[model samples]
Target chain A: MQIQIERIEHIVHENESVKTFFIRGVNDPRPGNYLMVWIPGSGQIPLSISSFKNDLCGFTVKRVGDTTAAMHNLRVGDLIGITGPLGTSFSIRGERILLVSGGIGIAPLLYLAIEARQMGKKVYAICGFERAEDIIFEDVLNGLLDELVITLGERTPLDVIHKLYEKRRFDHIYSCGPEPMMKRVFDFARSSQLGAEFSVERIIKCGMGICGACALPNGMRVCKEGPVFDLEDMEGVWG
Target chain B: MVDLSADIGIPLKNPLILTSGILGSSAHLLKRVASSGAGALITKSITEDPRVGHENPTVIEVSEGLILNAMGLPNPGVDIFLNELETLEAVNLPIIPSVAGYSEDEFGRVASRLEDAGFRIIELNISCPHSTALSSKKVIAQDIDKTRRVVNAVRSVTSLKLIVKLSPNVTDIVEFADVAIKAGADALSLINTIEALEVDPYVEAPVLGNVFGGQSGPSIRCIAQRKLTDIALAMWKGEIERVPLIGVGGVRTPKDVFRFLLLGADAVGIGSSILYEDLAIFEDVIEGLEQIMTDKGYDMLDEFRGKVISQILDMTI
Candidate 1:
């Protein structure tokens, strides 16, 4: 199940610290699907698909911990072992979809936005960054989305979500971001009586769901049952 | 080609058993493991009553092949778990139910129900390190009398092939193995995860939510072999009859499989290493073992199963 990395490039540099690796691999991973990128002697970590088409896929990686730092140092011709296309994909429910992304949590939602556009859905995106210069995927998102709202500085994605909610009602809210941001989104969805789902994070070992390493507070495994879960179904989570 | 199939009273496609508690909570996941080429699959340790287990961060990877977990035996209880097992009735692969309980009667009750529901091989879980969260009592496998009581209670219920799982937490694991064998266990899955703890140096707190966890993977490979050899020598001395041994802890590669077989394990149960390679590991290990056996001119599994045990004592003068 391991594939060779065909090519690699830095797709976006939001700032001095954050950069995206547009890795072209031989997998047609769907939106929300992930690949376990292995650097051999270094170690491996799960990278969510940001874009996939015709044997070319991308993983938007930010240099975070040890494994990711090693992954960031790879060149275009480097051969890395990739396993999966693992886990369930984000389920597109309605005609109008609202994507809330913050920081690197924008990775999976970006692919989801592209898919939503292909399905002829009205995709509304609220992307946030710490500074004005740190905003990424603005051009790509603008072309794919029906409406794109970029918030710079301390204005959180939740703030834009509130402003958007005051104007137009979304059929579904698909969110992935910092826990606090997702929690706020989950709370907003619950209070506003809107359908929403959130992509959660966990210490995943085997992306195939056998290992209980990625199990949530509920018995549900984040690797198998989700990296994405229906906000309403996430009972007692983040409580 | 080597005969990978084994008959430990019940039939197994190979010696690679998908050990309990990995993905045993659901029947769908069990079948997926079955399809993935595992010889057999053991369910998560289920008790008479439902257990919510511990809170988040139940399992974590400490290194490449090592894992620490204190899942506290989270299961849907026996009755609800049976619904999941019933779906597997159509699956051709062998289904072994692992039963855990606080007392002899509780273990007996669950075993009887599993037997009635048509499970042939039942693994009695007496050694879970995280069972402390379920009850204040020490692990049943740690004490000889409690282990005997539970095994005997399950033995009296039905004539199912009972595989008593032993804990590696004890000072003398062979004593517990002898007690289980004497109490009518048809087989034994030796060396459950060794009780150990890992602390976060940065935060100065235990890594596992339960504050302690069982250690598995390559770190415990030598320990598993040493314990299995010790118990095998005891069995050779007529302390207990030779039973089908399922060597469990820290098995990662084909060489480890042969090491366990040489120590008298009829089959090998892989738990933690599955986290490293996924279910694809079963196929990898099986293919590697086959190649190694062919290269060594070993035709049958019995050619090496317990071969190392003969060299353990060497009492002949």
Candidate 2:
């Protein structure tokens, strides 16, 4: 796919090192779908679509490396090249859904929460952060989600899930975070017989599948077969 | 009844080769391609040491069916790749490892290791366009002396079949092809991606991380065909040894494969087109080739292989 140059419509500083840039030009991106955000000479990195409305789409980026640090400097109206709404998106299932997010993984889940709320499904979120300052989308999730739980200071989202499972039952689980956290969530979901989906991250190149840079151990290209995969599809991936 | 089996030093069930650097990163991925019906598998270019390669945006699509990439030869080094190769032994297909190095000694050492591991075919990558080079020549294939020395170094260490991959960035690829063959290359695969650049006018900077990368896909097909035809004609005129040739660059369809074979390639490599069609392209191309063969009243590739070259020779005579 050719890169489409989009203008940054607005920018939101979500935290000290994280910002969400809402760009104009993406159309109909689903919750888990991601964009290969290009900063020209600095290079490109895959960013999940954190929010999509009308013709505008938002990407939540953390200042991790060169490309992302450059992205943090982009101002409103700056033109950046994008190639996506690429990869699989989360499949909305059941009347109630639980969102488990760790660190910046809250980006795509926040979008999923908004989408699920609009569909009249009860959306509950368990967001984990290294510190309270690192938390993002707090105000938005509190207002939009049916329930929001923030875990801080060594309390992982997995710990919250284990506790929350005792009080209430969820029909499905959606998670995006560090692999170890997601793997724990996957294990929990399987044991509870809850259907689950996850948005995974990898070193993506040629976001269109041909370059095997983002391929999982099972030979599934994360850029193509999924950035979001069903629990069964992820078998042998972590192993 | 159309038989597509081919022999490029090693025998293959068909002519579709999974070109190096596409999806050759791991054993499972190679096995996945094997299940997709590729005739042979060429691993990603492995070096003596692990290379992290360039930063993100190493590859980009300039246009449809066209890609610009400068992956910088990122690999886990030969030691790690050799373990992956052991897992690939269960694949039951010819797995040709593409070896690259910064020096002649590195090339020989890497190839010698693979030979010791019992691999029968080795594809020497002297054509990577964007890799860092210790030699003055940015790409070894650009310098005939460097290419010959690299090939000879590996040849001296291994009795395995050596396929020297040539670079299209060179002025006369046939000269390099001749030198490689004379230096003991058993076959040739051409052309590696051509050097190119993409500048984003909006950002006022080059698009790729490396600033410059190699171009592949349909855009380079005609250029690759011209280069292949030049070497084919040279072979026809007895200017170079008659060795197997694997034509690569923008081969997406059965007709593209037919054109390459008619130009005297023993087989064809599929690379960038995988971005468009994915793994199914292999099965799709194979079935299409069979249909085309059936329509042409030929049951085997040899009946039509180099047919165009023969006709050209007839016209000239």
Tell me, by lDDT, which candidate is best.
Answer: 2
Q: How much is the lDDT of residue A177 in candidate 1?
A: 81
- DockQ of each two-chain model: 0.10, 0.77
What value does the lDDT take at residue A129 in candidate 2?
Answer: 93
The fraction of correct interface contacts reproduced by each prediction comes to: 0.13, 0.79
Candidate 2 stretches with Cα past 4 Å from truth are B133-138
lDDT of 2 by residue, B262-314 (tens): 89899999998998888999999999999999998989889988888878877
Q: What is chain B's TM-score across the candidates, in the order shown?
A: 0.95, 0.97
Instruction: Give candidate 1 regions above 4 Å deviation.
Output: A1-208, A212-239, B134-137, B315-317
Which candidate ranks first by TM-score, i.e. highest?
A: 2
**CA lDDT, candidate 2, residue A142:** 92
RMSD (CA, Å), candidate 2 to true, equals 1.6
How far residue B49's Cα lies from its native spot in candidate 1, in Å, is 1.5
lDDT of 1 at A22: 64
